[model samples]
Target: MTPVPTAPLVRWYRTSLAGHPDGLNFRRLWVGDTFSQFGTQVGLIVLPLLAVSVLGADEFEMGLLATFETLAFLVIGLPAGAWVDRMRKREVLVVADLVRGLALLTLPAAWLLETLTFPLVLVVAAVVGVATVFFDVAYQSYLPSLVPSERISEGNAKLQVSQSVAQIAGPGLGGVLVRALGAPLVVLLDALSYFASVLFLLRIRHREGPIRRSGRRLHSEIGEGLAFVFREPLLRRIVATTALGNLAGSVTNSMLVLYAIRDLGIGETGLGLALSVGAVGGLAGALLAEPLLKRVGEGRTIALALLPALPMYVLVPLAEGHPGQAAVTMIATSMAITGVGVVVYNVAQVSFRQRLCPRPLLGRMNASVRFVVWGTMPVGAFLGGVIGSRFGVLTALWVGVAGQALAVLPVLLSPLVRMRDLPRGLDQHA
Candidate 1:
């Protein structure tokens, strides 16, 4: 037989294996990430519920609790990125998970001792927030090291699917458990999930590169990351879009449980069921993202995905005076639609940034983007609380939805709208 072009076949083989589970350390990462996401999803519900239902926290205090959970991203966000770069990302992931698990354990312990207080909840939230900052930066930075550049999108899709699945099940599970076992005891499950994540993480065998130290001042290192993000027009725009979105989303989220339980008279089961139903949209988004990106182009996908959800948010505040079942349905519908946009936007934007940055700057770049985007969360949460407390929860929802409507403007006006595909290999523009 004639030579079958060995070189081409070898190249094709490598390409075929790029995103497959067995080809890299992604399988273990995926498993660990799933557990972590499940824990986080459950915590998202129970933590706030623990404060509101158990400790009798009002709207402003609820906002404060939300602020504490995200406060670390604002305070240590920039420095955490620089720090992650100088350390083994895997180690950082492991340590972050460990810290979160331990801190979460304190909640159940406090509860068992009958010493559970809002302040204790706040402290634990703050600790978990700090660990989460490190974990997020490390996890994003670590993915590029684990998979080939071309397969980052695939890896992200799979990870997002896992997160989506967790979202789908977690709230309902948390509700049932909280109702059955009490919210305090339910926290223990979230803690256990984090521990499970650690075990899965330890099983990964992918060796990361030795830590690279610049021996430079911390501020300077941070500045480099900031500079990279700001210097790129597209990245800067994406940051603005996401920051605004987070601000709006946090405002709404901070008030959502309070509004649902108090204003709408949604029982725990109804609230959880609504949130769980909404997560189905996230799963759909994750599954559809790749194909949508291929069809619409990555940049356009980011821009387009956000628009459909703008009006969807209006359905939320508008549900205020409806019957309980109708209100819950409206809330679930809004969540499901918004969840789809959020997931699709995230998968596209995150993959684009990962592909755009050099490997060394991955940690800093991810951190910088998150710093800008997530930093807005606490501020928004605080504003939500203040607004909800002063005006009314329904008014706060209206204000939040209005902000969500405007958040799309940044990306819509950018060159992303005109482009068919996001550029690759360090090129910031199409």
Candidate 2:
């Protein structure tokens, strides 16, 4: 297949921002992304709160909610790539926003009708997950087309920083709203955020050409992409390690809030504040990633970032304070350190992926990797629920945090750790 024309990426900005002409278009995309992230973070806090508070969902139910949110990555991850490569990505993003918005809207509607149920939350979570699988695939693919290759790291950093900012603000605000209006109504904010994203997407003046599909075999294309990922040594290691990391992280994340409430005795407002404190680390990591990568190399940066996460993670189960000293000190420290590690690892790995892949294969390459890497989330979520149900939530968290440190093995054992820099040319994959 020939390289698709991505000139439309430039048309969106067609101007400058903060006195930087080169980044103007990116700023426009950034604006929409920032708003969208705020909404997502708000929903992130509110959704589970609704499940716990309104529906009285147990650990298994809460875990199931998390499962559905990521199940689509495993189910249609490959096919979505094939579809994305054949359609206008901008349109996919818009539709995804609308779908997520509509899906979230149902919760408030259900609440008004007094028909909201845990099962309904599960279904909507699945729907939103499906949309996200496509949106994220397209969003990653679309970025390479928008910026000069040299600036990819900058673009990613800006986007991540904005997301971190959202993390900082969204949860606190959502918690306040959840406390003020109740969890069900708090979802309305998320729904509106999606609509806001849709409007921003629609306002872009850029245009994309329709793909020709006369002789394309979808499976063949999907296989081609998958082959590229699994066959390449470096890509394989990254994919493997990421999958394990996510699986382990999900195990803890699946039960984090519940653990906070039960074990730590953290209230809604306090829970949000705890999460916000963590985002301070995320924000710091985003700001530091590019500079760190430049100094230490992607491999070293990843190693340094990830090595601390597990040790920090283990401290979470030990948090003793309810709302004051122990809660603020122990739980907050764990989350903040983990957040830093995650962001740094993400920025380095993502930048490496964008720099390494060929432009023509961007969408499928991203999807294939996403499939293998992200596919573990639901499994992990389910396991977390089972472990929490059978043994205990604290036990599940311990097992999860322990496994997180081991996720570094694949990359550490591979050639990635030996390098001072990522290979800019595909021929240097060795």
lDDT (Cα atoms) of all candidates against the true structure: 0.90, 0.82
Q: State the TM-score for model 1.
A: 0.94
Positional deviation of residue 149's Cα in model 1 after best superposition, in angstroms:
0.7
**Model 1's lDDT to the true fold?**
0.90
Total clashes for model 2:
1
Task: List per-candidate RMSD values in Å.
Answer: 5.0, 6.9
Choose the strongest candidate by lDDT.
1
Model 2 is weakest, by summed lDDT over 10 consecutive residues, at 10-19
Backbone clashes in model 1, listed as residue pairs? none
Q: Where is model 1 more than 4 Å wrong at Cα?
A: 1-24, 426-430
Q: In candidate 2, what are the lDDT values of residues 188-290, reduced to their tens digit?
A: 8898988888877776555654563637688998988899788777778888889999999889888987887666777788888888887888898898888
Model number with the top TM-score: 1
lDDT by residue (tens digit), candidate 1, 1-430: 7967789767755664334446557878889989999999999999988988899999999999999999999999999999999999888999999999999999989888989999999999999999999999999999877777877788899899999999999998998898889898899989999999999899889887677968689999899899989999988889999999899989999999898888888877888999999999999999899889888999889878888888899988988889999998998999999899999999999999999887788888889998999999999999999999999898888889888988999899988998887777654232
How many clashes does each candidate structure show, in the order listed?
0, 1
- Name the lDDT value of residue 341 in candidate 2: 78
Q: How many angstroms is residue 229 displaced in model 1 relative to the true structure, after the best TM-score fit?
A: 0.3
